[model samples]
Target: PFRSTSLPSSILRSVQLCIQLVSILIFVRVLRSKSMEEYSYTMEMHQSQISDRSMRFVGRLVQRRTMRWETIRRWFPSMVE
Candidate 1:
């Protein structure tokens, strides 16, 4: 008779464990989505940096193309600024 009463309590404990596992799965999914958003934001930052780096390269190329200059801004970029 006591065993029959304990059986229901064990079933209740198992149900609680299943609920905890489901909650953990939900938490993991939310974390994955948040990480994906951060990854995309970093990608956009990299794209902007590429444009900025290209602009600096363009200026250096123009200096090299035009050999006629008072100062050697080609060698010393600080002088160009």
Candidate 2:
């Protein structure tokens, strides 16, 4: 009768430990995945901002080129005609 009672207590302790370990592992995995998602989102935002700036720079260059050509045409209309 004494051995049977002690055996159940030991088994219960081991079961509790196992449950604690499993819950910890699950929590760590969730945190890792959330960090990865945030990292990817930040990277995407940075890339889009870089692309937008480059596009604006290109637009400015094109406008400058067109304005120079127009000035040349105005200064020497006979040459273009």
Candidate 3:
């Protein structure tokens, strides 16, 4: 009975601490990678391949401007809207 009473108090303290930490994290400024800078760097690295029929980066193929309208519609559904 003594152990059970102590356990609830500790659990309540830990729950309060977690709630505070989460609130602080929510207001904190996020410092992450500059994606646009990396994108430009990637483009520069593949400058020669940019003119090819298709460009491969990682595993995704940046396809060439296809003549088919269906392909474009499939790629970006919002374009039709």
Candidate 4:
């Protein structure tokens, strides 16, 4: 009769161990998900920086082209005179 009671107690302990292990696994998964979100946010920030730089480069290129065209137009009248 003592052995029978001890067997039930062991079974309950095993159940508790299993529950603890499952909870740990769930916690690790939650941490990994949060890390992924942070990585994606960082990547988005880098992309925005690259886009802003490209836009500025394009604007500068356009301004230089217009300046050169005006200079050429002003010199053409003197050259033809």
Candidate 5:
């Protein structure tokens, strides 16, 4: 009778340990996935910002070129005509 009770108690303790280990693993996995998602989001934001700045820069460059052409036309109307 003593051995039978002791056997059941030992088995219960092992089962408890397995549950604890599984819980810990799941927690770690969740944390890692959250961090990865955050990292990807930040990267996307940075890329969008960079692209926006480049587009603005190109627009300004085109405006400058158009202004230069207008100035040339004003200076030498006969050449254009």
Candidate 6:
């Protein structure tokens, strides 16, 4: 009884952690490959373009309504902050 319950919970926690790590790595790669620096006085518009492109690429498989920000918030603590 207890064994079954605890095992699944522990496994789920590990899986979630792995996914979060992969997401972070992918995020960094996308930023670096695009050579995106902090938006400057004249590059403010570019920031939004970059953000939109990143979001589309990373979140393509994830359904907006199903796995919304709230759901990922649980796995990625930094995202909440």
RMSD values for the candidates in order, in angstroms, are 21.2, 24.8, 17.8, 25.4, 24.7, 16.5
Runs in model 6 deviating more than 4 A are: 1-7, 35-81
lDDT of 5 by residue, 17-72 (tens): 99878756754664465333333333343344556776556445544566665676
lDDT of 4 by residue, 15-47 (tens): 889987875665465446533333333334344
**Clashes per candidate, residues 3 or more apart or on different chains:** 0, 0, 0, 0, 0, 0
Which of 2 and 6 is the better model by TM-score? 6
Q: In model 4, how large is the Cα lDDT of residue 12?
A: 82
Those runs of model 1 whose alpha carbons end farther than 4 Å from true positions after fitting are 1-7, 35-81
Q: How much lDDT does candidate 2 score?
A: 0.56
* Model 1 C-alpha lDDT per residue in residues 1-81, reported as the tens digit of each score: 446565787798998899878756654654465333333333343444556776555445544545544345557666554
Point out the higher-scoring one by lDDT: 5 or 6: 5
For each candidate, give its TM-score against the true structure: 0.33, 0.34, 0.28, 0.34, 0.34, 0.35
**Error in Å for residue 73 of model 5:** 58
Pairs with backbone N, CA or C atoms under 3 Å apart (clashes), candidate 4: none
Per-residue lDDT of model 2, residues 16-81, tens digit only: 899878756654654465333333333343444556776556445544566665676689767644
Candidate models: Cα lDDT each: 0.53, 0.56, 0.47, 0.54, 0.56, 0.49
- Superior candidate under lDDT, 1 versus 5: 5
Displacement of the residue 67 alpha carbon in candidate 3, Å: 41
* Ten residues in sequence with the least summed lDDT for candidate 3: 58-67
Better of 1 and 2 by TM-score: 2
User: Residues 1-81, candidate 3, lDDT per residue (tens digit)?
Assistant: 446556778788998899868644532411133233333444445555566543445213222222344565679757644
Error of 5 at 62 (Å): 47
Error of 3 at 37 (Å): 26
Q: Model 4, which residues run further than 4 Å from truth? A: 1-7, 35-81
